[model samples]
Target: MSTKQIEKSTTEIQIPKDVKVNLKGSMLQVQGPLGKVYKNFKKIPVLIQINDNKILLRKTGERKKHQAILNTAKSLIQTLCTGVVDGFTIKMKIVYSHFPVTVKVEAKKVLIKNFQGERAPRISMIKGDTKVVVKGDDVIITGPVLTDVSQTAANIQLKSKVKNKDHRVFLDGIYRYSKSKGIEE
Candidate 1:
């Protein structure tokens, strides 16, 4: 299909009552009851407009890449709005078959102890305002921004990664079980 046939794409997202949006150049900031999120879209050439309680994303180009960028921008805006209202949480479970693994949350890092019978604890750095909580074998990660919450969970899971081992035999690692909006109960 011709690029001209692709057509321009436009998307609108409804803003919550307690959420506020601010735009400056290619930077967008969303503030809500939970927290604030800053996103930079300098790489994408699109127009973002905040009107009343609605956010509008528009891409005039008919190129496939432009359409993709528009969709990604729309999703990012929606995620930012949801995060302000409900926040975000990622639940992870620690699994160890051979040796029991101990998980601890220190300052800005998550410490993995006794993983694969290792003497030194593996450290996972926590970024942004993400918080990690260890309850039994369950790890609850929470933050206002989705990226921060997901990144922290990934860090913990990566720390437990077993290299040069069989996946079926050595299935001991931190695994993300579920992800949801709002704080953990």
Candidate 2:
């Protein structure tokens, strides 16, 4: 049996007019109306080219792992485009049995108090320029970078996890209810 050899592959990403992308060596900077985002692709064995309104990610390797990395880079670039342009938002809801839980946004971290009637407060570190806003019973998290915004939301959810208690019955914690940019539940 004869095997066909693939010469090369490329991924193209189209961006909006208001967004600006700059590539300096392995570091990429994206600026938009919402904010700015930066990513480093130092280890990825792929070539990145940016145009006026589009980007091209070229992959020349035929290895399976290389293909995976190229796909991942492509997806990451797409996310960066969307995040810089439209931004990302995640909404969480505070639910408790009786003690009542409160979420506070500090300078660089989020403090979750009275979680499951616990006296000690749980803290979640905010990444990048992610903003956490506590309004009534809703916690709104927004940012221009997908990684930062999603990581902050994950930190908050994981920090308030119910320990020792049965998860099905003791559902008293901060749970993500809604989100944008394909993040939900």
Candidate 3:
């Protein structure tokens, strides 16, 4: 019989002053001035120990994959800290091929008109302190948190996607240009 061996590593992380961390089982909750965030991990072999002002992550067993999990956990913690401290932002651009599309923000809804010359205008809901604005062909989105801002922008882009058509031929749609403090494509 052949035996399999695994290796593991350890990492330590410090919680920022603006961030508050609460742990129960494999679930973690981080709260700050901006908002509260929650995350759950399944069968995490690593051990997380919290002291007075510091949080430590220790990898147990001999599993090399635990290192990746530890890094992901550290990243999530860092994101929570930064998000609570300064928040995040995302930006998108609206383009058109045949007809120019008009983008506008009204109250808590973002409206898109003349898209593919559709009879009805498309709308997307805005959340929290997120704001959507149209400056020429550029759509600017900002919020106190990354999820709200990025999701709002994505919703607008998804609503404008041209389905069952060649992307090169029918290129009139909204697209993401840049993202800050959050995931963007």
lDDT of 2 by residue, 39-153 (tens): 9999888899997788988885777777788889989988888887778899989888888898898899899998877888899999999888989999999888878888998
Q: Which ten residues in a row have the lowest lDDT in candidate 2?
A: 1-10
Please give the lDDT score for candidate 2.
0.85
lDDT of 1 by residue, 78-185 (tens): 888888889899999999988899998889989999999999999999989888889999999988889989988888888899989888889999999899999985
Q: lDDT per prediction?
A: 0.88, 0.85, 0.75
Top candidate when judged by TM-score against the true structure: 1
Q: What ranges in model 3 sit over 4 Å off?
A: 1-8, 42-45, 104-111, 123-136, 144-148, 182-185
lDDT tens per residue, model 3, 79-152: 66777766776778788878779988899998888888887889888876776777888888865566667788
Ranking by TM-score: 1, 2, 3
Provide TM-scores for the models: 0.90, 0.89, 0.73
Predicted structure 3, TM vs. truth: 0.73
Flag the better candidate by TM-score, 1 or 2. Answer: 1
Superposed Cα deviation of residue 155, candidate 2 (Å):
0.7
Q: Considering only N, C-alpha and C atoms within 3 Å, which residue pairs clash in candidate 3?
A: 6-62, 7-62
- Residue 37 CA error for candidate 2 (Å)? 0.7
User: How does model 3 fare in lDDT?
Assistant: 0.75
Alpha-carbon shift of residue 65 in model 3 (angstroms)? 1.2
